[model samples]
Target: MKSTFLILSSKRYNYYFRRFSFDFQNKVIKTKNLFLFLTLLVLSVSVNAQQNQVQQDSTKTEKLDEVLVKAVRVDADSPITHSNVSKEQLAKRNLGQDIPILLNYLPSVVTTSDAGAGIGYTGIRVRGTDATRVNVTINGIPYNDPESQGTFWVNLGDFASSTESLQLQRGVGTSTNGSGAFGASLNLLTDAFSENASAEISNSFGSYNTRKHTIKLSTGLLNNHFEISGRFSKIDSDGYIDRAFTDLKSYFLQGIYKDENTLIKALTFGNYERTYQAWFGLTAEELQENRRQNPYTYENETDNYWQDHYQLHWNERLNSNWSTNLGLNYTKGKGYFEQYKPEESAADFANLIEEDSDVIVRRWLDNNFYVINANVVYKKNTLEVISGISYNTYSGDHFGEVIWGSDLAPNTNIRDRYYEGDATKNDFSVFSKATFKLLEKVTGFVDIQGRFVEYKTNGVNSDLVDFVTDANFNFFNPKVGFTYKPSSSNNYYLSYARANREPNRDDFKAGVTENETLNDIELGWRFYKNKVSVNTNLYYMFYQNQLVLTGELDDVGSPIRATSGKSYRLGLEIDANIQFSKVFNTSTNVALSSNKNQDFNATINGEVVDLGNTNISFSPNLVIGNSLNFNPLENLQVSFLSKYVGEQYMGNIDNEASKLERYFLNDLNINYEIKPNGIFKSIVLSGLVNNIFNKEYVSNGYFGSFDYDDTSSPTGTTTGYYSGYYPQATTNFLVGATLKF
Candidate 1:
């Protein structure tokens, strides 16, 4: 067996070449198409043979049909479809990395990390939608919080260690839970129950004191029925930004029962994280000073937090052609970050009062989230369907205290408020979805989901005192989609989906409670061949009442109330994977997108002007990725990856308060493996070099309202106005080794 890897590292090598020799002229050069075909054919044959051999080696009670169990959105091998990243691939490169980083090489995916490294604050935008818009599932269960609609990957520290397989669905076709697949959906499955009890340990280190250590153990299959598996991991990093030190840890445990026609799984996991406030952006002058600011600065007063999750799943095949699955999921998360602010008559800093303590000026929150979700699925040839419901609940509280800080004062001056007051609330809702077949090789699916959301705050500053009463909402969301398979190797699809989101607790605390919604219409084409695959999609979106983050807020970070009259995104996405030959492989992802806030009208920084055509905040105009893999020797593999991001705004008002400059990033890696028979399958050594050129770049920032004058052509405010950019790491090098069992 041969391990596959392509290295595209760049170096200065001057090789003198004379006029073409007769031997060179006689040498054959293959076309790109031929190379792609051969590579696909070989890969398919190799993988197919491996599966057959593995299956043949295992003995079963009956000669049952070979069934492929998929841990993904759709469970079929439909062309123009899904790509599964295996555990081996995940571990060999960028271990302890976030899920988004694991999918960087796949089609139509653009992943960015706030830490300038893959281990923390990583995000993936399939096509053009942000992380919040993507539906994520772990072991076939939804993972995003239904209320806040945000996926905090940090909650699962070192989860990659426990994962055995993952799939990224680029377009909507299959039936699943909760929200429809607007941009893409990710599915991950942890390692299976082991046959024998054994424990293993692994550790790795990369840029920014980023390191991970994990241990895994599983009881071998017991009594032809039950088995258990568990894992623990700890990850710490002095984040790319100064002061942002991350100390995170998590654990996973599972009990499983499997047989010829039945499989039941019970699983639970949780994580605790404490990091200096890195969410806060920086100003221009700061960016110029080394571009990398420490997170534990004295002026930055932040809090710490931790969260946990639990789930149960059961699957059975009632008959040969009728298999069924049912799942129940629950999650609980609580944590907070603190800040310093001035005292006021509104009793704002009430929650921070420490018992038996003097008054001090400061603010922070103690937030918590809970969710209960269930789903069922049944599949058949030529027709596949799924239906399920979810009940989600969320609650959190905000408190203030007279800590050692003056309100609106520079240098974190000391101040203590006279009184204490706080606020809190809860929200709940339910939803359902299903899909069916239409015609030959064509399938259509429709989903209808609804949620009843409500929240409240107690104490002197509770109940959204400034806004209307009872800030509650009930919404109905519907989506329709179609997938056409023109041929066994070709597929096309079209889909439309819309979503409505209620304001989070913070949105209301600042006296701004508005419904922010998004609607998307999409169309795309897919192609698959023996060795190469491609997917391209076009999208148009509509934003109604989007919560535009106001640079200036009333004592809180919530955006001021201002409904976007009209805003849309139009773009094209193209992703392709090709292997030029047995020793070379390449892939590229490119997004050409344009987002504009049409007719944006509001009293932005006290000015009423038509702020239309302004670039959507945080939406980069262009994102691109390219990679090349090459193997110069049988034991050595080298690769290079390049990423580019076009300039973008930190605010919708197009002001100087916040904006990020265009930047490009590059990465390189090299690995060599030695296959030793019997005792060890392979001995591998690897190294990764990040920010090859040490280019300075900012991941994201917040805008300041004071600097902008209504579409006054907001210049890139490098100082004071913009909170701060997550300064990317400078060029760094790492090396590690692996021994297979």
Candidate 2:
């Protein structure tokens, strides 16, 4: 068996190697320093557990840490549609890709990458809703940008390594911090403090000149009450697209103190990233000519950004029935994306110069965010109640500077501000939720929240126009649900929830956007027996004044949205896991949905046309994912994964040119572990082959329409459609090894 496995692996490698070209020298040189850094860091932190005092049971600390997120998480029996992912599951494919890409196989999920290889600038959409509407929290603290309401995974490269577990709650699952969840709410729990001293070094190399190096260490529990753990990671990738490259460095450190019923943690994590711009995708002609071509040719066309996050958490268990948690966070972010404009009008750049000339400019965002959260949980025999209050304040400065130009006005100098603006926002919310057993076979759930928000901005925007806004909103959200379990193997649930969200900064700039509201209803069933488990969920979501995507991108590559008077999404999602035998198992999920904008109206050919009952932009009708796993040996595992996305339109007008074709993809993954008796305890090796069939596909794009008038035509005017597409890589592979001591 061993010989056969070896032969198969060799043949597969030979086949792929023959079809691809590798710059071995360049890759080796680029990763040499990373290897050295990992070795030094691991050696310095390596320590023997026998030298330190024995600690309390690690399970106690783990339980206390779990308490930190209890207020925002739901259990399997709850009336919610959610999925939980563990570190073990994530580790199987944690090779250089972003978290969204790693989570691509989940239910109702769609992920895209601008760099084509999932190493930089990734985005995720759930149930036809974009990232801006998806609420994200790290250890129960809001992680989305307060102004844009978007989550930038590039700023936290390789964060999956530090995550112990995560949960994705679809369709306004529960009350959480930050913006309301119109699509989904995701919460991540950081790694728990280890009870024994340990250290690990990991390295991976893949296609497209991609490589990752990570070093992790834990001091274990010192004197039975304290521990220190940290991780440092570096990732580099030359993407499939021309001149698309990413260089990222990140660090995570935490100091923990814990006892039988108390836990205190202080942590800091941050990343510095520099990546060549690739957001401008290909046009139709360009896609057919050379899909990998990039239009931007400037040498320094890049984005440089750094963000640091600080958090402190305290959890105390007063008694069996009462517990409390307090969390504080301070985040500082500063970054800028540089661009070179040719033959640009000087008046468009704050009148910095008198005439149209080629220029180089840098747009910067410097921001500070502060958050305070307090929550308490009470539990008895048949009832559990959680109440929490969160307050956050954000202040950000937006400015642009002209670095160089062919021509300049008198008194104008280098590094002068072209346009400047500032914005501040304050958000406060209080929520109370309870779950209680009402009868022998029934459980009831209720949640209520009150949120208040104030946003203010003043100054000139990049277009040299006065962009000032002062908006305030008050919202009340409520949720009710119930679960019925007639037998241990069967469970049924029904729920209804309401959510309201204020417009983001871009919304205000686009036009007078109103607050959006959602009413969601969910029905679900769970069946588990023996080695098989299945979950089915049906959901209906109705929106009022919803900000739907217009399939257009701003100058900075951000998606543009417009208010839809009324919209609805109805879907059925089913996910299952079945163990057919001791060595073989399978997991599958499918989502079938119908998303539409009622009585949609648009300006076509210089006329307001009522395009009644049109499909919502970027909302696909079918999505399916499946995984087949086989454990040939006790320490070896191999899996095959598949994904299919149905065709979807990119515009509300439903024009043929705005449609994205459906595509299917397959991947192969292998993992093996070896135990040794020497200095290292274990060595693990992993390999992944993505898009195994080498299928060409585009996962995301944009669409727009322009009207032109012609005297020879009867109507005298015509509408033209233009679109851009982001093509994904055909086939790629990543292989990695990890050493634990």
Candidate 3:
């Protein structure tokens, strides 16, 4: 069955590629092999599964009858809250940027691109909480690693290709099944199975030689009872910063079987990213001398990563009042960045640089991670609830090779092979939530969760060492909220939630150099129609043995940190959306916040420093975002948006000298939907001008450890401090076409 499937898939791809000139590109050639494999799998599944059960169950389909986002007990929604950017909306807002950068127009949101233009290594902050605090999930499976709980957007380049819609839930939200939601929860729904047989070819190009090409295949009306769909895309770009480049590829596939009361689904996808290590940020002086110089920079280092995910789900209904959601997911990740180190001859450095070795050492990140989660949902006349549990484990080897060290004919030859520490981690969690309506206008909800985690590492050495964190434990956290709807268009809600978060790897590893904390808060809101909304949230986030990144900068330019007496965050956020008519729309958001260390005394470079009443590092006083849309003609529309950030300090001295200056930035987008949704229909468009004014502003960055000529030296020289920016990209443009058949 599989062999026959492969042959059929090959023939189809050959036919498809024959039409594209890029089919001959070097990268495209190598990539075609992988797609060939995917095509075979899809073909095999399509040919062998003669029944619709593999495509979808007739009963599980969205009837196109009821509104789901509104009926659900999710907090991301308010009568005034915004959710779901239509396919058209996403196309019109095309900034040729990463998901985070593209969504920067949202209220109280800020995005940073380590790769400069959203093409690689980008992140989004919601209401002050960074990506580390956000809960990201794709099709209900948690996207965050169980151990570090971090989401690397770069790993899934152009993932938006398969995504149909996404919702960002700010702050505490509806009871979710995975990691705690501290900052926000992003739930993504990938493209649903198409009902017909059609294919689309899309291509777009912009600044930095950045471009993306995509091919999608739909088993058009395949037997009318079954559908198979898949997407293959490749994206590459020359980063704004010197030496920065991105080469990435990704895939998405799904098989669905539907019936009036049952639904079964099989989904698989993955991505690979090859990039340069631009983490070593430049200094103001360095930025001037050579804005593109990479100090940690070396030769042949490719930050390459690949991930593959698989899931199976079955939805069954036993009766009118009871149903169950059964699912299983598995993810595997592999790849690493290779780096070169200069040779050294000291006795202690002897191991780092072997005798007669080459001029550089290569390092690799053999990281493989996976997770499994299962959920069961039950519903009654006025109550609904779901309980679930999950288990995850992963292992990674940070190994290296002595390609050369000290022996080469060069200024500083270093190359040798060595085993760096290899680490393995495991994690699990159990959670549940219930929602009940006691009266026609009243509803209540509660969720409880607990988790267990452990880890260990081997292969220790002189400067680098091994560590262990093997343990099993549980933390019980609960939340409660109420919603009242006097009419279909308006609703009032009050929610009180208490959540706890264990320090992930970034916190512990960057410890003594960074900060971490926990939060507790209450929220209130009112929604007036989907176009207008109001909210007031009072949160007193408390920290236990807080690790606050001080506003102080080390000689090396990394955020310095210390154990604080206590740290607290009190803040408020407000957002609104208004539609003057079908042709005009406006949205805005504001955040007022204050974060500080209550008390503490610390020593830096052997000097006693007072941290009492000092502001925490990277904490901003205010953030604002505004967007406006106008329709100048029936076939054209334009949008303008601006993001304003307040001054932010980098250290804890309450120092005014080292603060990042506030800046206002804007972007523009315009699109014309030609022949939209018609026979031989299509859309042709162009997007322009991101960071329209080209305002130069620095976002948050860090200072590294000070290097002393001698441990006893009074003045230690600071190596170049590394930093990142919410760099406003130079004005850019993109032109693309989408066709439907």
Candidate 4:
């Protein structure tokens, strides 16, 4: 009877294979080889298993979903310095802020918001490294933008509500898909299918007229095989800065199918955001007068964008020793940021008119990205190996149009494009990772990857200059590490990794043609007892041709970068959690670092000056965070969180005028739950008070220098510095309630 059932299943699989082939041939031919290979392997394995008649275990499929991220995530005993955050922990702070703001208290992290509040356009930096160098993945699939290599949290407003878990690996921890991790890697797993049907409604209101509304539902397991879950969220904020407002809408939907040995999921998530411009931060004089002031006065100056994503994942448990995962993704993004230029030169706008004129123009980007990932895992008594291949392609169109202008040229329409450009990129990589027990209490790990990238662009840039580029690069990254567990409560580890990365679109435009490289070494210790856990690590990172920020902003508010010949960072990080008693606990982390640019030279005071071993820009030397929690009642909890960041420079030159002062901030959070036997299962009420002391501070800023002819100087020219600061809100409050049924 088992043989007969196998034969019938084979026939059904063949029919599905035919349909899959048809779709592959027309839609995703570029990645057909790996897809075909995996499919054939699955078929061959199934047919050969008929002779053995292995009984399927339905319980195994419930845990198969974890395989989606098994290839990229690390365990506590692994030779990696990392932290994991669960959905339950995030719920306490799931206000209208972006993901970066919610993760602000993590070890060695700094967060900034452009709207003077945490409601819109937030960014995160790890180990003093910017977001561009921090790789991000969703369920092991790449999430960073291909062209910019940056993660835009504003695009996924209220995404924390849909996340099941997230892990942050500091330093070049492992080899994964998409861009390389020069500083850190973050991967998130979406909500898992629930076992029981449920519905939830959450609403929150905060300062600055901020509010959020969310609706979520889960169909649970239907007939023990199928499940569906979804969420919709809307967020609005009248920001703390003048004229800075945000309106955002986002949704997430997923369908899952599970069986005795297989788990397949299809997901779609996206968001649309309209945010008023606040990137032009205030100068020192303006900040002293009114810290919430915005330099831009145009009423219509705003950024509007919409992005959509589709993902399909299949995980198969081919017995206990072998498994495979295949993932496919498609992302569509389109957007435009409108700007008002006063007295702009015609040459800059493609000679649309022969003279200077005030114009309102829009810059647009339309892009499509596709990815295919496949991996196979083998696990035995004391050995495990994972090998994977990933391929992605991106095509983007860039153009700009003048929507209104004081003067017009002949035969030009209102939406005539002033500049147009297009770009295409293809990235392919293959990697293999293995871990095995070498001794009674020692384990070893090795990871190797080869990556190839091809980038091409054509047409004119926004500066009305003919821009063209065709570049190709190949990189080899290798990592090795070992873990020693002396006892059940103590572990020690050491690791070394090497990574290489190419420049982004802006870097190419700035005449940067060299790739960057990093050599990182890490040593760590971990301890776990009945009521205490501690993790500490030391890291040394050396870089060549590193793309360091130049402390300048382009016309569109994007930061500019220039390559530094040599640089290094040395840091020590320690984090611990202590449960003093049943009702009280504490969590704290501290980071101390020294970041420097060796033999740095800059053009200062009309001469090239060597600033020997200067401090790296925006790299603070000391950062500390702490959380004190109390649970006096069964259903009530209160947490007091605090953070302190030391002073740092905004420019590599170490000029006194470019310094940003140190700041200490504190927040209070409270959560209470009511279990009712009425219509609702439970009601959760939460309140958050930020900057409880009403402290005024600035968290981020920019500085630059320029040389100009000066009659008073001894030389023919002199250099002057200019700076801008982004101020944080003094005091703010957010309160919310959630109903679950």
Candidate 5:
């Protein structure tokens, strides 16, 4: 295995599970349910006895100390519009689905799955902004690819099982690592150490031949100083669309050393995924005829990817008023997407081949990411200050090979290579943040950051042309805010922030591009009275040279975007939670927004037409989600979840023919837990029925126009539009169980 470091600390658990392997060419499958059952049963008996014999260690009662991640996380008094999902909240919905699906109900969030059932290739849009504009980090380490500026969730299968907490900050809330947060930022923290030794087994089965199995174990503190924990999971699912299936496996391991004044930690986690492609959605007419149909018909048309992460962290408390943290991180990622192209390609293949032939090709990407991050903090009676810096680099190679072909030269090898290219990016940033108490009930905040980005790429393009592009960008982001708290239960805040984002890899390929800028303003209030809690925020974001979707798709089905002159998004979001009674509780969120592109122009039929004040593509005007929970029995719970999305257009032109209709969806969930004497500590059973109403809906699509009348004159020529739709599944069910000891 190739990695940044080799340090295996859990000798006791090393014999239990072997290290992971990425080889899948000759994959084998074997069942060991019987052995798992008996092993867990025996461990249950021993764990119970161990639990009863262990005494309460004084280390467990020591004062809670802050972790190194606080340097990157948003503070309670940061005057930012954000939300937090605790471990308890995540556990309720962590059954084999992507993390985006679990956060679908959050304000201004929209989720879509390529497999149409939330198992393979999922996507998320927040406040009308796509995932590429969102910055994501895990335990203060940047997770977004520097070149693509995108996060591939499939590479981290079943990550929700290891996540202890998640926080989302909207509208470029604060300064952070990696790419700029043009729309929002999300941070995830893995599970904290357990004070007692424990073991868990979980299994799930659902509609469409879907199943998931997981095992987790922990070793309590040894010598009151060190602890170890690990988890392994496997998930398989036959998707709603034809041939859209997923088989995934992942693992997580951590070793920690903690004391009253210092903490050190090392971690390793990653996943391997093999899934059939479902990127080619159906046409609108085909969607009506057969909503479950998939256009891709080739066997072994799949995507294979694997990612591994390594991190070393150290934190020290110099004194009551000073603290510092240092972290080193590395990630190794490799993947390929295979495709089958039909015959008649000799002349079109840049004359690389002598004769027409049908061929199977694979595009591969192998990359390495390295980073060093450090931060220092100072706090006093009425003021706090933090200073941080980070440097990270990404190097990747892209290549393609012809694996099989109908016609070949006598000595031609199937592994013949073709197009090859590589890209490198270096990013560095420094930031300072401060908070001061202006009065007893009023506080002020300020943050400033300076960043430098360098991008370089050179290689042979698909057209057999030698291409090279080198770019450099410098950006300065500033933020200021104020918060007023008249009482402990009521609070009000207002903030303004400015951010800049550089062009990504795809953007460079299309043409020469410039950096984009955003100016955002946010105002929010929070109130809590008795059994009710409410939060509301109003935001206005203005953009310059923004990249907006133009309803066109590339060869691989990714949306095509063009630089718009100007754009803006204004929205209001509200979230509320209420406990109606001892047995009933409810939570709801609503988002209303107006997104527009000003003075957009396009060339059609040799004529330039100015489309004045058109709606931004794929940005809906309204979105609502609600959840109702009931606990009728001592250990039984039920929940109803609902979502509604308003009509929206698929293009910046806002043509009525390219509109996507509104949709309403509902889901039902139930969970029951059992507590018995002796060996077993707890047993949990859970189930989910999604889209209970069987509503037929299209969540995503594309539209474009072409000159139908090929007349030389611009006056008489006409244009026609075409569209493709991605329809979602009607109804499905998933049932699961968990045993802990």
Candidate 6:
């Protein structure tokens, strides 16, 4: 009966294949071939390795209590380049900054902030890939908005406080849930259960009138079965830029039940944030005149947003060889950025005015996301397998409203919305992966995933343009690799992966764009002995239809991007850590890459001109970061951090005028702990001095072009270029204190 069912399913799929277009049919065939090849390889290896006795020690397996992130996380032995940040490391930098700022020192990472500081809206790029291309997850749940494909750290202010650990995998990582990992993937696991009750209070004050206060309490492991923990935080910052202040509040709560073979957890977390608008950076002239000037002079210009998340997770260890995990998650998000416009057209305002007049308007976004994820794992002897599936739905509404206007009409209401649109999306995917020990020192790995995505939009945009769009996409991603361990202290790995990503809402609005594809190959070597460790990796990624910056800004100040014909990124990454003594250590990481647009062309004077392999925008050729730690006393520690970024272009055109200069920055950090005999169990004090050299630099910028005519000159036509920059703050300091009992 099973054979008959399989035959029927194959026939049905064949019929569907015949009905599809030629290109789609080819894609389906390619996916099938990839699956078949992987299956054959796995089977061949298993047949030869099954004769050897397998190691079935339960101590070698991961515990079920930590299964929340197992669905999307990769093991250390996996053939990937990754970095891990623990809670203790985060606490040292969690004074009053966002998560992106905290992760700025990782390998192949770059971060920027709009408020001249890290307290407000911030952005992160990995391997020159923008936030939109980076896949993010929290407890195995997708964190990026389905439409924008971007993670807004501002909506989760001080989230680092609740994160127990996080992993950053660079370059087409293992298949995971939600959007594909084109450049990188980040997964965060919240605080785990504690065995002892605890209470804590934290406070910090810094430059620009920045301050943060937090309170936390935990009822750890009640009756050895249940536990509850919660935290509340409030942060305020007067940014370095004029009128760029921030006001934010956030909270987190968790309840857990645990036993020998079962674990269930419930979590609720959210944040409310408001900040003055500072989206527009400074032009060259403006930067030289007044570096802190803000274009928006209106006192009430601000962006207000709040987000809430609820998640439930269950993990059951059916037996020593089998374990399963299930997760249900929902997120509610709403926000609006308000602005005051001068000389606005009556037609543009939905005919609210008969002539041009000043008006106050708001662009709002309200969205809800629901997701279900499940994974089952089987481990026996030298073979392990995992099968995972996930489904997600997102509904979002975008609208524009006239809050205040200089009109005389009495019937006009402030609450009336002029433009509104709704967008809905559904994403579903299934994946299977396996690992087997082929030899005493060699392990093989394979992963395959199939995903289906659909997006629909209805209504008009703020520009009154019809955005009735519907798109459907199917993707198959496959990864295979092997790890060879020459000894306990040395290992080498080689891997190749394929990844595909669908266009986001913003990309759709720009124009019709094809899906993006990447073929990445990686080779790495690691060596560890005594107090010294070193890791180096070489990667080459070939891309098709990759989206790149065009040096243009849309109506709402968002950067406009266009798809390129072909591109490639080749790089080498090295990271090392050395312990000089029992109390002194140093860690350094460096990345050097060559990124280019292959056979690039542009239309000039109605003629297609070959640019010939120009540099890709925003991808610096070299990035270096280093840190030194010292323990002068038993309870006091001091550290120094430094970073350097090479010059990079702001647009794919790669004109000399559109380049950002190289920059070097340094920071100093110090922390001290005290254990008193009084009521307080421990007290910690910390301080951070940023930009210790007071160096002035621009971390991000854009370029624009304009056509000009000069009748008096020899040439009657001229193309002019302009550049803008987002400047960083000078030397600043932050002081913090924490009390625990």
Runs of candidate 6 exceeding 4 Å displacement: 1-52, 55-59, 408-411, 604-607, 708-717
lDDT of 6 by residue, 1-741 (tens): 423633553454344333332132222324464344434433443444455546554424667756788767778777888898999999887899999989988989999999988888899999998888889999999999899898889888888889999999999988888999989999999998889999999999999999999999999899999999999999999898887999999999999999988999999999999999888889989988988889889888999998999999999998877788999999999999999998788889787654677889999999999999988776677777777778898999999999888872457788688799999988877676777776789988777777778888999888878898888898878788999998989989999999999988889987855799999999999899899999899999999999887877777767778888899999999999999998999999999999999999875433457999999989999999999999989988898999999999998878998899999999998999999999899999999999999999889988877767766544565567888888888899999999998
Which ranking of candidates, highest lDDT first? Answer: 2, 4, 6, 5, 3, 1
Worst 10 residues of 5 by lDDT: 1-10
**lDDT tens digits, residues 218-317, model 3?**
8954555567888888888888766678888988888877655666778899888888767666666775575545656565655778888897766666
> For residues 1-741, what per-residue lDDT tens digits would candidate 1 score against the true structure?
211210110010001011111111223223343334323333433342343242223322211111112323443333224566888777757456677776676655666665566655667766545565577877656676554455778777878777877777654433344444445677777776676766656667877787877777778789988899888888888767666677788899989888878778788998887766555545577777666664345554554556676776667666643445556666665555556433343334333333333333434345454444433333333333333434444444444444453233323223333333433333332222333445556666545444445555455343224422256665556566778887977878777776666765455655557776667777877778887978777877777766554443344322343445567777887878887888999888887888778877645444466766787667777888888889889888898978888777767767655667888888887888889876655667778887899886766555654443344445432122445566667787666665544
lDDT of each: 0.59, 0.89, 0.61, 0.88, 0.81, 0.85
Q: Model 4: per-residue lDDT, tens digit, 1-741?
A: 544753564464444434332121223433475455345434443443334333543222226777888878887899988999999999999988889889999999998899978988888889999999899999888999988999999999899999999999999988889999989999999998788999999999999999999999999999999999999999999999988999999999999999888999999999999999998898999999999888888898999999999999999999877889999999999999999998888888887754778899999999999999888876655556677888898999999999988987777789999999999988887766766665668887777677778888999999888889988887889898999999999999999999999999999999998999999999999999999999999999999998988778888888888998899999999999999999999999999999999999998778888989988888899999999999999999999999999998888999998899999999999999999999899999999999999999988888998889998887889999999989988899999999999
Worst 10 residues of 2 by lDDT: 44-53
In terms of lDDT, the poorest run of 10 residues in model 3 is 63-72
* Least accurate 10 contiguous residues by lDDT in model 6: 20-29
User: Candidate 5, residues 1-741: lDDT per residue as tens digits?
Assistant: 101111121221223222211111222212253233223323432233233332432212112234555655676656889889987787777788889888988888888888888997888888988888889988888999898798888888888888888889989888989999988999888878777888989999998888989999889788888899999999999998877999999999999888777777788999999999998888877887888888888889999999999988887777775677788999999999999888746654444445768878888899999999887765544455667777888999988777877886566677676788888888877666666665568877767676778888899765556668788887878788989999988989999999999988878888947999999999999988899999999999999999877877877767777898799999999999999998999999999999999998877665798988999988899999999999999898899999998898888887887899999999998999999896879998899999999998888888999876656565667777899887788899999999989
Task: Select the stronger candidate by TM-score from 3 and 6.
Answer: 6
How much is 191 displaced in model 3, in angstroms?
Answer: 1.6
Indicate which candidate wins on lDDT.
2
Stronger candidate by TM-score (4 vs 6): 6
Deviation from truth (RMSD, Å), model 4: 7.2
Candidate maximizing TM-score: 6
Tens digits of per-residue lDDT for model 2, 482-584? 9999999999999999999999999999885579999999999999999999999999999999899999999999999999999999999999999999899
TM-score for candidate 1, residues paired by index = 0.77
Assess the local accuracy of residue 260 in candidate 6 as a C-alpha lDDT between 0 and 100. Answer: 88
Point out the higher-scoring one by TM-score: 1 or 3.
3
TM-score of decoy 2: 0.91
Q: What is the C-alpha RMSD of each candidate to the true structure, in Å?
A: 16.1, 15.5, 13.7, 7.2, 13.3, 4.6
- Give the candidate order by descending TM-score: 6, 4, 2, 5, 3, 1
